[model samples]
Target: MSQGQHWREQLHEAAAQGDTASLLKVIRSAVAERADVGDYTLMSRLLKRIGRDEASRAGLRPVRVYIARSVTVESWLPYLAVEAAAAGFWLETKVGGYGSFAQELMSPEGALRDFNPDLVVFVTDVEDVAGGLPDACATGKPELVRAEVERGVKTMEDMLTAFRHHHRARLLVQGLCVPDPPVLGDAGDANWEASESRATQRINEQIAALCRRLGDAAFFDENRLASRFGKARWRDERMFRYCRLSIAAEFFAPYARALTHSIKVLFLPPHKVLCTDLDNTLWGGIVGEDKPSGILTGTDFPGNCYRTYQRYLKQLAARGILLAVVSKNNEKDVREAFRVRAQDLALTLDDFISLKISWQDKAVSLRELAQELSLGLDSFVLIDDDSVECEAVRQQVPGVLVIQAPREEPWRLTECVMASGAFDTLSVTAEDRARSDEYRAQAQRAQLENRAASREEFLASLQIVCRFISALEAPLSRTVQLINKTNQFNLTTRRYGTSEVESFAADPGGLALALRARDRFGDAGVIGIALCRTQDGTCTIDTLLLSCRVIGRGIESALLWYIARWAASLGANRLAGEYIPTAKNQPCADFYPRHGFRPAREAGGKQSRICYVLDLATQMPEKPAWIQTEEDLNNEPGPSCARVNEEFAR
Candidate 1:
């Protein structure tokens, strides 16, 4: 039998077996094999009997999503579940009452409040909230447009805020969809004043702005998604008439992907670097064979595709995704191409954080690159035109995400990577914008470290400074980002959302401190966060995490020193720290013990959780001598370390 027939036979057998193990295993294999979405829609029918919590133990992270919509979404739930599962999430979904999203969202005793979802999705359209918007557009008044935006946005904000008071779920709000053929016809496009499209776009802008102001909320542009799918086929009148469905059944999978893609970026940890191949991947020809000036990369037929890709890579670098060159070309040829052919290229020599151009195996080069950048292999995404190299890396360095750029359609490489969604992030901040430059600075630091004779001498010559600020004064977005993503040096390995971070920062009986580090090289923005709660006479550490970028720089030491002093100043005589073991956190197993924290035998420890305690009135940890803390330069002596010990905070 053919391979396709054999696969179909296995899928049918697995479904007929009627067991959770077989069903889940087949679904995962199908997703990896790029099976049709309709297969998943049918396979997920058996998921009704599989326990959501059981999925967690079966190697999937279980997440509950509350989808609130005015239209009928029952027919689309299976598609949504299967798409979200592709991102390592097993979905448990709750659907809000039809045409009652506002009441369900705002009511404290509503089903939404009881469901306690990890994400709350607002799938709405202009026709649902502002049905009069079309009539308002028919009248050529800008004030009516403004009034509709204001009314719709305020109502959304109110319901979202009310729901926020009860749950910490991150928000994913869909924007207003401007229906395909203008409701007012060609005359509507005569000018901006009469354009229904312009009015709908204005409302979408307000919705997006509201999400940003809400903090931890993300916007999904339904109109942009509909526009990509032929606007005329976006919805089916038959489905709408029978069940009030918002989109066509045939395109339900794509529609579901639109929503889950937003969810993946919001809750899933992002890849830090994009390691790309050079020969035929970045340009139309190999650098060595093309001889510097012969590569096709200007404004021509196939050349334009390469040039546009180069421009897109620059944009990704601007958003803080580090770029690197990973190619099996001579270093001399690569440098000569960029150095001499500068005018012909959109990319320059300084764009990449690291360049691996040699005869070494790509997997070996990737490992070396990870070590040089102080990042984990899992935090990388590789794009290469050569399928053999892609498969080799996928086998040798299994953690890395490999996107094979087919040689036949080089122009579609960017589209394939976008579909992979390897670099999706919840939000891009100023720190993200400065990421590539900071890594470049790290290379400079590496050079200085090599020049110094001893480790102590190297640290002292760097002039590192640590700035401590109250978490309330810090940007909660970055703080929460660090909390969710940092793993190696994290003591508890606990993840939290913006709402919980805000509550901790505002609590009168708590302490939330964030640490920012800078040196002779550059500023590593907000690298560490420590959350504490003081009750009775003891200060307990709830979460302490430091970014891998500053892992070996004694930054965590400086942070711990400051926290110990601050807890003493608050009149607490004892401090407590917890260690939760995970696969990625072996580096932090001895963190508390290294900082003069002894095992708290009085507090019984479990097999998985260990507790440590430090005497605040007596055993103050010794601060790293090479680092200069903000408190050290202060004229006022707010608090002092009670004692010093031999332990290092490394």
Candidate 2:
């Protein structure tokens, strides 16, 4: 037998026994040799078994997932489960009985509710969504297409409503794939008015709109997957007819992979920092050797590729990914290239949150960057063309993910980054877009700190303004963003979706107060969120978190004092708070004690939930003299907030 055949036999044996370590070793060896690791299905199946086994063991929590599909999916579920594992999840998955999606979702006392999955996947295809569309030969009317689209959308909305009523699982709806065999020959692609293709497109659009309206539901675009693999290859007529498979068996691995990538960013805590190289990675040539203007950047073959890549990175920065430069170039030259030479450069020197341009080892630089950013090393991705540097970071840093930058074609570099799914965001907020500006402002603040004679002088000169706006009046997007993203100073470290945030705002007994700060330097955007629930004469601080960028400036103290004052106005005798311990939130472990809050009875067995309370009958918590407070005049407080104020006034 050939050596390749021997390797395949060993892999198959390892998979059968659920030996994941051996399977991983085999895969890595094949990758090192640049050999084809054949049969991804088998590989993924082994991984699924391993993940399930790990989930069963203590201390390894798995994401409880349920897949509800209109078509048969038994054969491909293992692959999907395995993909979920690679994206940093162990899956405790339940596949609904064949063609039982409606029964599983709509039934009041269904098995789905009993399973209690964290994420629910609704999978369907064009046949299920737009099956009523007229034949290609028949002259279709736009009205007919519109009706079909509405029907498809209503069907999805029904499922979502059912799930929401019964449980709070995050919904992930897979959109209909682009149909094969164009209904209007090749003309349907261009003709959007009265074609079967147009009808399919309409259904997908309506589905997306429905997900947005539902707030928590996310539409995973399967049409893009079809385009990536080609419809002919991705779909199998035989499987559809006999087994009712929505996608071909051969294409299942990739489909699961793409879906898993979207799932990771949606449900999991996302990566924050992107550490990239300078020479040959961000631009065409070495800045030192090629000279400032000599570096290929704009309006050319390789140069345009680099330019486009930089533009993509800049966009990522705008969406709250902290960009850091880690290269072996002269710092002066690199800064000059960005500031003076690269006039058309998409990325400016200020775009990066951290700059480590020196002849030092990248692994050292990455550690320093993470330390400066106050983020875990695991929250970084190192992009470099040099394999040695990539390997070095991988070995030394160990936690940071390394992606090799494309050398031959610079434009493809962006594609490589996109494929990693490290930067995918479920919802974009104003704070996300203004992240670069906030970091620049932070730099200026740092300079002021260094120049100030003392901390009190620094705080006083800043002319800080802390405006408290009700959640309903404030931008819900940014509030939700802070709840999900802020780590260090977060009291509870609770992550909420847009729907959950809105629900808190609308709660009669609850109030969501968002704190927006600005100083002499600039506006810090929405930096803190305090969610409180009041009942009787007791008010409980459900969540109080501040962005780490604004931490150390007495923002947390200001937020606590504001919450106490607001609670007092609501006729509350006492304010309660809790500190949930997490690895990254050690900085906030003593937060409650540092404030005026006193220790209360510990809830949850083993004191897992540490409770603290402040007597509001006494004088209110004191705010810093440097901090000025005001109401947001432009936007009126929500009815809930006004009601609280009125009740307290009485």
TM-score, every prediction: 0.91, 0.87
Which candidate has the highest TM-score of all? 1
TM-score, predicted candidate 1 vs. hidden true structure? 0.91
Best by lDDT: 1
RMSD of each: 3.9, 4.1
- Worst lDDT run of 10 residues, candidate 2, spans 30-39
lDDT of 1 by residue, 1-650 (tens): 75455546676786577555666656656665755645766656655455676666655678888988888888878877877775667888999887789888777777887888888898876777667777777686778867876676677778778877666788898888886577678665556674778767877787788778777789899888888997889878677778888788777778877788888877767798999898788887888887888877778868778878888888899899999999999999999888887776788979898899999999999999998888889889999998899989978997798988766777897888888878887678888898888888898988998899999999998899988776655588888788888878888877888778777766755767788889988898888899987778788899998888888878888888876766666677888998988878888899999888988864654547888999876788667999977632121133332221112222
lDDT assessment of candidate 2 = 0.76
Over all chains combined, what TM-score does candidate 2 have? 0.87
Per residue, candidate 2 scores C-alpha lDDT tens digits across 1-650 of: 76567667877887777666566656544433433334445555555556555544422336788888878877777666655555556667788876678789777677898898888888876666567765432455677667777787788778777767666777888888767676766765556576666667777888878777665578899888888888787878888888888788777667877888777766655678888898898998888999888888887787889888899988887678889888998888987888775566888877778889889899889888776666778779989999888888877986688899977778799999988788777776776667667777777878998999999999898899988887655577667667866777888888787667767767766678898899987888788898888789888998999877787788778888777766665678898999988767888889888876789877766637789988877657777889887665223235535643453355
